[model samples]
Target: MLGQDPDAAQELMHSWAAQLSTRAQAAAELSDRVATIASSAVGANGAVRVTVGASGALTDLRLDDRVQRIPGAELAITIMAAIARAQAGLTEQVSIAVHDTVGTDSETGRAITDTFARRFPKPADEQPDRSERDARDGW
Candidate 1:
């Protein structure tokens, strides 16, 4: 119907353009929020803690004096486990961001969620606790 009326066609096009612009703006805002998201997790009964950015890059790591009791190799494992735990939770944090912004139904949201899921699949929950392991070994 709008084909024969140039003014109507123009108006229709303008409406579509406005909708597209709104979507683009929302996506941009979502990207900014997601980029700023930082996830943290603790492991080995809080002896090791780590924070990771949206890119799963380690941003901060904190080890209390309790770590001095850990063997060098065990400490390395603990640190890595903490990082993995942080990375694993990154997706959920980003999922909330996406849901609040563009929403999970959008293609952009799905892609963002999928990428994080693949990059930081959950770690095994059976990671040995520092105290328990040490006690078992009579350390």
Candidate 2:
């Protein structure tokens, strides 16, 4: 018992709950985006691999099942999206498969782009400010 006021404890719990809900919603959306991106990658049996370090860096990334020679733009977009998701505290793995072979790598590129668009969507006009939170909430 920290001997804090009971009302203060209730406020702390409420703030904690609100913060957790916000994070959970963001993470869920990011997960859905990951799945969409992974399923849309253009390659033969493609997979989007992501690795994150404890410090939250884009530790490692791979696409199309380790195959290289894909367009640099495509790879960059995919890697960037994975990094974004990781930086947002989402999980570190996403996979997508492009079933069409007409363009192969190019199609995969398109798929990756589409996934990025869907995942990143337009940013909200307004965002919550962490500085406004109560100190007892502790994020």
For candidate 2, the 10 contiguous residues with the lowest summed lDDT are: 95-104
Worst 10-residue lDDT window for candidate 1 reads 124-133
lDDT of 1 at 56: 94
- The global C-alpha lDDT for each of the candidates, from Candidate 1 onward, is 0.87, 0.45
Q: Which sections of candidate 2 miss by over 4 Å?
A: 38-139
Candidate 2 versus the native: TM-score?
Answer: 0.29
Model 2, 32-55: lDDT tens digits are 554433221122123455655433
Flag regions of model 1 displaced more than 4 Å.
132-139
The CA root-mean-square deviation of candidate 1, after full C-alpha superposition on the true structure, stands at: 2.3
For each candidate in turn, the TM-score is 0.88, 0.29
Q: What is the lDDT of residue 72 in candidate 2?
A: 63
Predict model 2's lDDT versus the native.
0.45
Q: Judged by TM-score, which candidate is best?
A: 1
